[model samples]
Target chain A: MKGQRFLGLGYLGPYIIGLLVFTAIPFFGSLYLSFTKYDLMSSPDWTGLANYERLFTRDRTFFKSLNVTLLYVLLTVPLKLAFALFIATVLNYRLQFIGLFRTAFYVPSILGGSIAIAVLWRYMFATEGLVNMALATIGLGPIDWFGDPTNALLTITLLRCWQFGSAMVIFLAALQSIDKSLYEAAAIDGAGKVRIFFFITLPLLTPVIFFNLIMQMVQAFQEFNGPYIITQGGPLKATYLLPLYIYEEAFKKFNMGYASAIAWVLFTIITVLTLIAFWSSKKWVYYAGDKRS
Target chain B: MTDITTSNDLTMDETARAKRRAGLRLFSTAIRYALLFLVGFVMLYPLIWLVGASFKTNSEIFSGAGFLPQNPTLDGYIKGWQTSTPYTFGRFFWNSFLIILPKVIGTAISCTMAAYAFARFDFPLKKVLFGSVIAILLLPNVVTRIPQYILFRDLGWLDSFLPLWVPSALAGDAFFVFMLVQFLRSLPSDMEEAARVDGANSLQTLVYIVVPMLAPALISVCLFQFMWTMNDFLGPLIYLSSVDKYPVSLALKLSIDTTEAFEWNRILAMSVLAISPALIVFFAAQRYFIEGISSGGIKG
Candidate 1:
């Protein structure tokens, strides 16, 4: 019995070590570091609340990045979810060659958030690039995609939206798992297609929607690659997201203390947002077989 | 004669209704295919363009927006393979595989072991530990990057793959562990109980019974690790500094940075090569890929 107990612990040993070294210690370490002034070369000096103070009081870029990130999350998450849901609905049909379309949509996601894709995006949205070329043929736009500050953020947002396949696949799975009999019953009652979808499908899908929303929101806040490679947070810091700001502060400027403070702020925002999502989900997210509140 | 005319009129009404219904069905089908094609085109255009651009000369790439190269050439592939870096693209590919293979195997082993413990055993602190796993999954990795960097730097493990894959060996990915735990929960504990009754130890039972039953989930874990590691940028960017040690992702970035004229064709070709392994792996085991995603590996 003692040996069995030890064996269980043995199995968990690696994970325990990882938690300590990678997660727990660093988590607290960063929290502590957020309160101190330290560059990589020097030992950290205690400066209680100074980093936080500086961030709140004097950091214009900090607030700008925060606003930009918030705007990004606002724009990308809903749009991506809608796009995913729409595609997944189309895919939910028992159509021939559906796998090909699913794979096609998913291919970009499989190459998700890579430097290569970001680079490809940069060129694609360039002034004389493919997007503009297509626009010209349509007699519509040679719009400056990454040039104008107004449009630069949108460019990056579109890139995030483009990789909606992961969320779509999750939604597809959820849609597939939904009780088909419910749909049959609705149809038998003479419920129109849209009515059944809005009343039945949408309600049942709220749980997955909630999940995707939270995940995508968190991802959008920490988004780096598209802004980093495609826009370089350029055209007047339009896409200077919080994560990039933290990276620049920590590594580029070697202000680890301030960077840690920024990171903690981000951490807090994510946690709060996630909590808010969970709290709000109680109203709409329906889990089958669970008692209604 | 009047009664026969009335019957003909009723038949005409029935035919009209049927024709309208058919038209609606055809219209809906057309709309569905149209939407699928439009979205698929948007999803795939960049990749298709990348391949086409790979064969075009720098000047040719600028001349037209069309995917077809006016003058198709192998110069991009030939030149991109010989990057200006001391190491070639082939070296970077090897480096990627080196990181990917070990990370995948390590993740499978460590995650399965930890998940098995969480699933089958009644251990102390299990609840807290499992909760921590979920919490960690929610925690953005960017928050941990600086402190991890400092820690690894202090340990003199900078500029190495150790900082990258060693953590996987320790089941650092809480997502995979959680996923496997979920998988294990869905499985009946009968085989494991049988093995225990037959005097098998925990490890032996895991190897003999649990592992074989857990093959699909385990394969999903491995596939995800493979694809994610291959496409990972930030990890390699943070940990590695040496050009020789650079993986395909970093190496591709390095080529862009170092090249003065910025040969789009060559860079695109190298980009194609950089992503080929992941694309090939995904296409080959797409079942596992989709299974992994649907089974709760939510992040792309």
Candidate 2:
């Protein structure tokens, strides 16, 4: 057992080296770097709290980007999850050509994160784009997706929400694993579909929902490609997600220290949100041991 | 009206009820299919339009929202392939492949080993190490980006593919490790134990036994690594400076930046090509891909 203890390190050698170099060292190194002023050209100069002070007190763009990021996450995560669950439920029913429909739903998610899709989204939401033309055909005038901040944000959210296939696929698996007897019993008791979904199915599926929520929230928080490509966080900085801000600060402007601070703040937000989700999961997320099947 | 229920003299009420039930079922099915088709169309329209518009003449790209071109041409594909940059799209694809091949292969091998150690054996600080693995899993990669960049810069790896794939090669991506760990835990350890009884070392057991069993999960890891590396704009954007070193993702963006009036068709054509690798791999290995995602979410 003692020999095996050391021997385990042999197997884990590459991962350990990676974890320290990439994750551990950098994770804490950034924390230290956040306190000092550093540009790529020079060594970090000690300036404790200056970067953070500016961020909290004077940096207007920080708050704007922060607000945009929070709103983006708030809008995208729930909408995506809800859309996914809705679709998953629909697809769960035994229908002809179900696999085709499933493929159609899922294809977007596989490609959604690519810069290619982001570029595509940019064109599709243009003033004279297909979306507007489609709306025109319906007698509704063109909605300037990029001109209005809300619409622009919604447009990006739709891009995120459009790729709900992976989450939907996960939900489908969970839904399928649900005991048929539970549904049969509910039907025998004269419960309606909606009622059964709410009382029985939903509660049982909370764990998966919780899982999807955390995953989607993290992804949404770090959303860059769509906002970056479509508007470049533009038309009045309406879509300036924190990631864009951080990227600009760190790379474009070379404010490494400030960028690190912003990155830390973003990290703190995710960690807290994730911790809250975990704490809250105790109340709602049910672990069905053998009951899942 | 007969009080007794008989096939010969079916009650009028029961007949009506059965007919109504049948009608309701049929109606519901119709509604479900209608909704599915409507939303599924919404989900797929952008991609469909991308492909359709890729073949359109530049003049006809903004002609209307319809995906079909009035006069379709391969002009977009032809010009997009011969990008304005000194290097063509093939160079960018090769660069992306270079990064993806190493990263995917590394992730499959390194992550499987790490997952094996964490899942199977008792080690010193195993709990702590595993805890950190989960912590790193949740930790935002952005937080580490700057410092890691500096580290790589100090290592003189900037402007090269080394910085992009090296860390991942070393198992820096904790999510893959966590996923593999979850998958491994769900598996039986009895096979490895039997291998141990036959005097085979752990590495030999892993190579000869565990890897075969771990094939699906490893394939998922590779596929994910491939797609993510392909999609990654920021990594290459940050690290690679030379035009020749750009990946497809960065190249696509470069096309957008350099082109004054965006040639929508050309951009769309390249977009189609850039996403093709992922799309092809996904649809081909879709069953394992979905199973991998579901198992990670539910079991982990």
Candidate 3:
């Protein structure tokens, strides 16, 4: 027992110290500071619910940013996951260069979140950029891409959807795990390809699909870079995502308390959404080895 | 078609069904190629535009509105490099390397240490602490930024890269720790048991036996940290004030924010430059990345 104690301490000592100083402390500190107004240099003053109240009633842009973020989440998550699953299905085929194709698809996702890509997004969608050029080629006269509020949000969402690699890879892994014999049986019973996909692949893929959905929704709510760089919260605050709104409020406006309130709201939103997703997934998600099934 | 072969002898209806299946197969094959081509084009188009724009003149970039340049030139690269914001583009490149190098090393060492401990040991309150690590993963960075800022400010660590470096050094990357822990758990425990019987301590078992075996996991963690830290805009943007202290990511934003007319060509040029190293690293160590993604996905 004495030797076990010594071994435990020796093994976990660094981790314990790190968690205490960095994670546990900061976590509680943030919670406490949410009730106060602190702007870095000045000492925090107790504001209690003032920050939260202001966020709900006084700030109009807060609501706008919320709408923008929710819209982004709505637009990006379904399209991205659908596209990823589509690509994963394609790659699951017996292709000669499957590995190469998989790698090629993944590179964009890594590059997708980058400053360069965000910059590239802005450039590509700009009035005189390649998108307009392509429209010109089809004799469909150039349309205002980023200049219009509707197109601006759509453009950013499309940029995010393009980086569907992580979800695709997940879908790939899930697709590969599906037993081939089920498909064979379905085929023997004269099931069409489309029917087999709907019955077999789709049912089997529900868990991964749910996982990707929850993750993407959480991430989409926190979308900052694309809007920050491309639209700067926009032609009319159209592309102003919640995270960007919090950042501008905290740093640009120096309202840390208000920003913290927004942050808390974001946390609540994510928790509620995730809970809802999990609850709904019970209808669709299937575990392979479950006796109940 | 293949499945039909596995079935018993075909009757008249089955023969008719087989003919229909062949026709459907040919039709589906054409649709498959069409879908593949459409998806491929959608994925590849933006990157091609960026690459093409990088070689065009300011007028060509501005007026062409096309993927291919009317008259391509390397002039954008020259101007982007020579006239980028904050400093010459060279300094931004150096800043990225300086920051990413330390971060990669620090995260690797600390995360692997903690991962090894979690993998090898069964201590008191193990599940509780691991749960905290998982909880922390779900708490978005914004929720913690304010208090972290206060802590840094009180310590007078603001405006320095110390905050970024210190957290990594102290092993605050719960995701990496959890990932490496899972990978280490997947490894056979018998070798360590053998080492334990041979009179080696936990530390010696970890260092002499486990560390050498966990190289692939360690390398993947390092690559992920390197790319994430290198491309990080928010952390550096919030912390560092001075232009010289700005990493390439922050500087890239500054290049646009400071510009009056939205210089498209220069931004693309700088974007290409900033993205090259991570791209190169990704291509070089891609195998490890694929493993990391798969393992991390299931665990995450």
Candidate 4:
């Protein structure tokens, strides 16, 4: 018994200690700091509800950021997953150069949201960049992709969607796991290709699709790099995401307390959305080997 | 079932069969080609444009016609290398590498050990601790930044690599820990059990038996941490103030800060130089860059 206890401690001590010092302490500490006003100088004043109240009622940028973030999530998640599924379905077909195609499609996913890519995006959308040049070739005048508020969000959306590599890879794995005999059976039943896709593939792929959707949504909600690098909260705050706002508050403005409040709000929003997703998933998601349904 | 109905169906099929087959072939080919073109454009155009722009002179870049550079030159590359002061391309790359190597090693070692403990052992409070780790993934980094910054500040660890590097020694990456735990759990315990039956202690079994089995997972984690830490900008931007300590990412940003009035050729060239190491690393380890979606919920 003593040996087992000691072994357990030996195995767990470093993790526990690290978690306590880094994660647990910071988590609770930040939660506490949300209620106080400290500028990293004097003693923190415990102001009850001031930060929260200010965010909801008074702060203009807070609402702007919330709207921008919501827009980003809504636009990016669905299109990205759909594109991933489409690519996965296409790749599922046995082809001669499938490996090359897969790698080509995946390279962008790996490099797409990187700071380099973001800088690239900035240049591409600049007034005299490639996009405008392409537009001019067909006698269509150039549109300001990053400069215009209406179009800037779309640029970021497209950027997010371009990195559908991870999701595509996941969908591909799921597609591969599906029994070949199922497709054979469908074909033997005189079902056309479209019918087989709808009746067999789509139904079976629902779980992966749902998984990709939720993950992409959460990730899209927390997206920072593209807008931060490309637009920097935009010509008119069009790309001002909540995370960016929180960052600006903390580091740029040195308002740690206010930033903590933004952080907590973002957390609550994510938690609520995640809860809703889990609840709705019971109706839609079909886990294989789960016989309860 | 009548002969008249059968004859009518036969005639109809015979007339349309050839036409329909031709149409189907055309449609499928079109669909395939269309997909090829669209996906190709989406994947390649931006990257190609970036590469093209990097070689373009200022006047040609501002000219902005099509994907090709009408007057492409190596001016940008030359200028990007020469422009920055106190933060040259080679120096920043070395700085970035210095930070990345330690963080990658730290994450791999600490996260893997923690993962093994979580996966194999049935210690007290294991469930709660595991949950806390996963939950921290959702806890936004911004929330913790202030308290962590303060902690580092009080310790006088700010402006040095310690603030960035030390926590990594103590299982800084919960995502990696969670990933390794899931992977370890999926493997059968028979090997370790046999080793234990032969009088191998838990630590011995872990070091010799389990760690060997976990080679691929460890490598993947290491590569991921290397890329992430290499490309990390905000942490280095916030922590390291001195120009000498600035990593390539921060250095690149500093170069681009004067984007409007500054030379575009140099800026783009420097950006290329800054990101090349990560790009090279990623491409080299490209085969193992598996998108393991199932590992998303894992926390260290």
Q: Which candidate leads in TM-score?
A: 2
Give me the runs in candidate 4 sitting further than 4 Å from their true place. Answer: A291-293, B1-30, B64-72, B259-262, B291-300
The per-residue C-alpha lDDT of model 2 at residue A152 equals 92
Best of the two (1, 4) by TM-score = 1
TM-score of each: 0.95, 0.96, 0.92, 0.91
Clashes of each: 0, 1, 1, 5
Which segments of model 1 are wrong by more than 4 Å? A1-6, A291-293, B1-23, B297-300
**What would the DockQ be for model 2?**
0.80
Candidate 2 Cα outliers beyond 4 Å, as residue runs: A289-293, B1-20
Determine the iRMS, in angstroms, of model 2: 1.1
lDDT (tens digit, per residue) of candidate 2 on A40-93? 788999899999999999999999999999998998999999999998898888
For residue A163, what is the lDDT in candidate 2?
A: 90
Tens-digit lDDT string for candidate 3 (A1-293)? 56774465455666677778777787677677668887766877898888888888888988888888888889899999998998889888755567777787888877877899988877777676668777888897777987898899998898888889889988888889899999999988989889999999999888788878877887788888888888888979999989998898788887777788888899889988888887887788876785341
Return the lDDT, model 3, position B15.
89
Cα lDDT for residue A263, model 3? Answer: 86
Task: Return the DockQ of model 3.
Answer: 0.57
What DockQ does each candidate score versus the true complex, computed on alpha carbons? 0.64, 0.80, 0.57, 0.45
Winning candidate number (lDDT) = 2
* TM value for model 3: 0.92
- Please give, for residues A1-293, the per-residue lDDT of candidate 1 as tens digits: 76665677789999999999999999999999999999988899999999999999999999999999888889999999999999999889767798888888898888977778887887888898888887888898689888798699998988888999999999999888889999999988999999999999999888789878877887888898789888889879999999999999988888888999999999999999999988988888887787552
